[model samples]
Target: MSTPSPSSSEDVRRTRILSSKLYFDVPPSKVPLIYSSAYNIAFLGMEKLHPFDSSKWGRICQFLVSAGILDKRCIVEPEEASREDLLVVHSEKYLDSLKSSMTVAKIVEVPPVAMLPNCIIQRKVLDPFRKQVGGSVLASKLAKERGWAINVGGGFHHCSAEKGSGFCAFADISLSIHFAFVRLNISRVMIIDLDAHQGNGHELDFAKDRRVYILDMFNSEVYPLDFNARRHIHQKVELLSGTTTDVYLKKLDEALEVAGRMFNPELIVYNAGTDVLDGDPLGCLRISPDGIIKRDEKVFTFARSKGVPILMLTSGGYMKSSARVIADSIINLSTKCLIEMQGEQNTS
Candidate 1:
């Protein structure tokens, strides 16, 4: 078979995006907060081996609902991403590699997963990830229509189209941008990744693609340490391990200002990971709870000021308290009027 041209590849991706059920029209009564019970990964207590709180997605929603910040009925449930949707970004060989239990075990960094059958691993682990991927893709459409959206379970930033690592098994961020480019008629997209670790996956995927701009503020001392990926970042802010909240926020302010001047984007993808919290083992930064809230508020304020639609993904927070912190930050965003949780009353 002849190798497809770049134009032909683009056409295939566009066709896949158009035919995807992941971008179904959400009802007016539903909020742009996309999530589903399927987004949570828990089975046989295997999730406990990793430091990550596998049930954090569900906990975040529970906190919002109990606090009356969100109505369960108003939350938009996204479909699980089908194989065709995965093909939009992932190669056939890469997708095929996922069928190996050992391949998945390495990606998620849980050794015991290698012992499980591929079928069990697929249902227990990958299904939830694919659901979150779908949510991330749907969030773009909702954000474009509603001015902002949040997917409670996505932000798999360490996974690229051909590889998965750092507990990230899929490139939801890259997939979301591609879907928006084709389905929403968006030409320019900005990714604001403040996850305390380098967003190497999306950076590598969009390295030469001028349509996408990445502004990544991460702990330089942390994991992945992808020097080549760091070269692709349009705006990079590297911080140390013990950096306090004040210094972090100041750097963020300066970075956002520079990003604003450098690129004008039609859409913004905010990877708001709570892993930057003071005690997160993986993130290694010392941003306080209040600081996380302020950071989110600042990003939303920036997007609002620029009149750009924003979609947020809860990325890589590992602590047990991450869920509560994420919930509180979201509540703070609503209090600041950056995002209106009242779906039925929101006119803009």
Candidate 2:
């Protein structure tokens, strides 16, 4: 079969995004923060083999609820992204490749998953990721409408249209942006990817697209070291493995100033990955819990001051303490008036 031209594939992608139900209207009672119970991945003991905290998404919400920062009833639930929705950014062949149990095991980096049947993997693992993808897409719409929105379970920045890696099986970030372009009428987006690992997936997807400006700050010594994708970052900030919070924040301040001057974006996509916490085995950075709070504050304050709608995705922090830190950072955002919680009238 002949490969489709870029323009033809773009047309098909636009059609899929336009027809997706992921961008449904959220009521006033429900917050723009998107999540669902289905976001958690729990299966036969296979999930235990991975270092990732599969239930961290649920735990984040649990902390928020227990702390009285948010009500369980006010949380917005997202529908799963169907196959048609996946086609917006993912290729048909790429989606088909996921049918193999070994393919999934490789993407998620879990050896035991390769032993399970594809049917079980699809139902238990991939389905949760699909729901998170839906949440990410819906978050863009909600952000455009409400000035800011948060998806408690997204920011799969290591997956691209044609490949998956670093425990990310779907291109949620790319899918979200495409949905915003077609459905929300957004033209310019600034991606502030602060994950400990390089956001190679989205960088590769938007490599030549001038509509998106990427500001990525990641540990220089990490997995999936893609030199090709590094070329796409507009403001690439590389940190050492054991960099302290002070140095990290200082660099971020400088980077944010440069980013603001370079791109007048209509939307800001903030990938707030808590993996940079001091004890995270994978992240290797020495940032404290307070540093994480201040980091989020700085990003939200930057976007708010620029008058750009910001969408935050909780990405790539699966440590045991990640949920509590994330919940605390979110609470800090609320207390500092950087973001309004659900059920409250949005004054911004």
Candidate 3:
């Protein structure tokens, strides 16, 4: 079979996205947050090998419910991104590469996954990732309708069109922005990535795209040290290891101010990775839980003040305490009126 040209493939991808069911109508009764039980990954003790709390996605929702902040019925569930949906950003060759267990194992940083049957890996690992991708895409739609939205499980910032690593298996951030561009009629996007790790995946994907502005603040001493990706970042805040919360927040204040002066985005994609929390072995920063809460608040406040719609993705942070921290931050957002919960909207 003759290989299809890049333009033809691009046309095919645009068609697939136009016909996708990922952007379904959410009820007024539900909040603009997206998640699904399938977003979690666990199989035969395999998830334990990595520092990732594979179940963190589900646990965050659980805490939100138990804390009386969110009702279970008000949470939005997202469908899995079908193969056609993934092809929008990932090349067919890269999708074919994922059929290999070794490729998936390396991407997830879990060696045991390579020994398992590909079927098991697909069902237990990749399925959850696809669901998260769907949620990320849907979040853009929600953000355009509501003032802000959040995807409880996405931010695969280490995965590009042709590569996956650092526990990221798909380029969900890229997919989200593409969906926004094509579906939501959005032109400008600003990515505020505070994941404690450089978001090389989206940076490489949008390297030459002028419509997207990237503000990446990450630990300088960590993984996926891609200097090539750094060039793509519009505003780069490289924090060193053991950096404290006070310094981190001050840098963010300046970065946000500078970014505002640089680009006025119609949409803001916030990669709120809690790995910067102190004691996260991989993140290597010393940001405290309150600092994380404040960090999220600052970002949301900035977006709100600018009258820009924002969507948050819980990208990287897999510690046992990560769930509670995330839930608490969301609650803080609601508490501070940065975001409106279903109950709050109804009460108002």
Candidate 4:
């Protein structure tokens, strides 16, 4: 049998995807969904001092890839901050600090890993977020051109303008928004942040931008120092602790209605965090795994009804070892949602 050249194999399209952009770091450990069902997946990770090893993310990636959720060919790992791109939302100093912490590993004083071994390595594993900017930039562009598409692992919305927070090292969502406006001819954007924690980072970045409309569903008193009044000067809702899934869903229904009435977005960006699972260490609201599924279904359904594309990003969820399971569940729901939304659209 003759061997196919690597370049020839590279030209093969794996699936009939509505999109072609799922990113993983060079190290498979950096991709959480690689283990689920490796269809429509890509490896974009690197073997740096990534939190991947610490998080058993490599195992998670294997599971997703083995399960056939993440297709391996679309992988795209990268290095360094996007010089001009980082300037869109993050300050030069913060970008420098991010590089310093990962390069020399000497400037990192706050992280639990303290020195964060292999600064260069850390940057490699964390490549997904920056590429997320590119992925979502592509997703949004596709949404504009084809009506729907997706970019997994792009919603690190908790990080702020000045610094990183809640394990989020990059501001993928904000950067993507800027990319859309600057490169994709997009404005009048809407971000529906359902990460279970206030999207304080987004609030700080988009609070004054007239083109962005943010709807946040989070516990008021959570990590990362949120300013409730300013969090959504335009529109904010703080769900209390001990709130059940039913109530949360009802409130979400209402919130979705409000978003529809007020923003009527042409492009919808959803921060679908699975941390809302009752046992999530960082979340205040007690929602179940099934509840998380329902939440995503509703959000995707609503966005589809408006005849728009939803750029879904994975944001905050800190369940340690359960991270893989949590990640799988989120992607599972997300995959199922694409089916449901298409069905709903076809029927309608």
Candidate 5:
């Protein structure tokens, strides 16, 4: 898109329309059962993709498809990621290493991780992130052009710039934010990662950036074993396990309020992880489904009220089939909220 010059008071009267397309792009084979051989990679191991199961996401999308919740909207069919897109955020060496199931026989003895062909790895890591990043881009684009839009697949917040961790191969929020910031020249992006895990990748990548504000709510002792966080320019909250939904929501409210006071966000990335649900073997915190909806509703409402466009990304949820349930909740809330935004604009 051609970057247009910012406007003054006269331009305020000519607000552009936002988009209303929610993207759902997951490859058929990519969404496999967590324990299947398809999920095994050389170094990534047999762990379920983060906390949310891909099978569940696949199932939920299918559910949405069957229910006709997703019909006649702008849809992005899954496509293999380009080397350029990967290069935008990952190193060439790492990208090459990811391509070859085995690393160059040199320095350290590489672990016996499942050796996924670069094509496979690219699909596993890049496919999900691309949908998320591209979805956000499209959503943000549509909102600017129409009024509002959404991407059904996103919230891959655990991903960093260089490597994959917590099942995240790449940083969805980072790439999307950078794409918008550089291409569209929109500054002040606010990312709210309400997953049960820390937005460590965001912290790792943009903790010091003056333009990005990352607010993460995660239990310190979850996966990756690196819970020690030094509050770099970003807001970090460590929620202890056994914390009730009320306490968690209250803290989230505080953080959202604080973020509002500090940054007038042009765009928001919301990582709605469902691992917080009870019985989620991976997540430490316990947030019921209803609680999650309530939390999501409040956050979406707050962002809309502030006139900040939001992009939803499904980050982590490892409760096997329950991944679908969690993802469905996020999609439902986002779809409803976006439709409401459309309504408000029409009324005005």
Candidate 6:
């Protein structure tokens, strides 16, 4: 078979992105916070085995609603990304590999998942992930239209085009950027990854692509110590395991300043992972709950100052407390006037 030229491949990708239903227009009455109950993963007590809070997405929304920070009726539900959407970034071989129960179990790090049939695994785990991928993809469009958006799920940054790792089954971050490139007519994107672990997936995918600038602030001693991928980061801030809240925030401020000087992007994709909390075993950092809130405020403030649209994705947080912290941060953002959770009033 003859290899497709780069231009041909670009044409194919554009076609897939244009034909995708995942980028449907959300109503003005709805807030740009993208979420769906289907974003949560739980079935047969299998979720208990993983260190992650599988139902974190739903719990975050529940907390927001209980606190009256968000109106549940106005939340936008994204369509699940179809196989065609997945093909926009994923290789046919990689998508096919997901069919095996073993491959999925290894990627998600759930040993028992290998024993269950692929069909069950698909419904319970991968389906939820795909829905989050849809949310991530749609968030960029919403952010462009509304100045800001938050996908309560997504940030599967460990999965690249041809691989999945560290509980990331799909490359939602890369998929969203690709969708934005074609559908939104956006050429410049900046990925601000504040996850505890490095976002090696998107880093590798955009390694040679100058259109995307990455500012990755992650613990240097964590799960995905990908030195090769580290080279791709336009601005890399590596922190020690026991780095405190003050130190983390200081580094973030400096990084954002430098990033602002380096790249002028039209959109910012913020991977706001709560795993940086002091108690997180994986993150190992000593950032407090209030610190996470402050960190989010700083990023949003930066985006606002630059007059750039920003989209947030809840990435990797293994603790049960992550949901509460995330909800609190969103509330803080609203209090700071960085985001408006209340839907736009229809004056018509």
The number of the candidate with the highest TM-score is: 6
lDDT of 6 by residue, 120-161 (tens): 999999999999999999999999999999999999999999
Mind sharing the TM-score for model 3?
A: 0.97
* lDDT of candidates 1 onward, in order: 0.95, 0.92, 0.94, 0.58, 0.58, 0.95
Candidate 4 wrongly placed segments (more than 4 Å): 1-81, 99-112, 116-129, 228-233, 320-348
Q: Taking the tens digit of each residue's C-alpha lDDT, what string does model 4 give over 107-175?
A: 212332444454543444345445555555455554554455445455666676677765566676776
Write the residue-wise lDDT of candidate 3 on 1-348 in tens digits: 998998887788789889999999888989987889999898999899999999999999999999998888888999899998998999889999999999999999999789999999999999999999999999999999998999999999999999999999999999999999999989999999999999999999999999999999999899989999999999999999999999999999999999999999999999999999999989999999999999999999999999999999999895899999999999999999999877334545
TM-score per candidate, in order? 0.98, 0.97, 0.97, 0.71, 0.73, 0.99
- Cα error, candidate 2, residue 167 (Å): 0.7
Per-model tally of clashing residue pairs: 0, 0, 0, 36, 28, 0
The model with the greater TM-score, 4 or 6, is 6
Model 2 lDDT tens row, 71-167: 8888999999999999888878999999999999999999889999999999999999999999999999999999999999999999999999998
- The parts of candidate 1 lying over 4 Å away from their true place are 345-348
| Runs in model 3 lying further than 4 Å from the true structure | 1-7, 343-348
Model 1, residue 3: C-alpha shift (Å): 1.7
lDDT of 5 by residue, 1-348 (tens): 864454542142122111212223332222111111222223344324233454454555555556555532323343333555545556666666654544321111233324545565455544455544555545554444333444555565656666555556556667667666654568888878887877777777786678888777787677544544336537777777777788888998898889888888888877777778777786777777778877878777887789877766655666764555654564666477543321111232
Considering lDDT, which of the candidate structures 2 and 5 is the better prediction for this target?
2
RMSD to true structure for each model, in Å: 1.7, 2.0, 1.8, 11.5, 9.1, 0.8
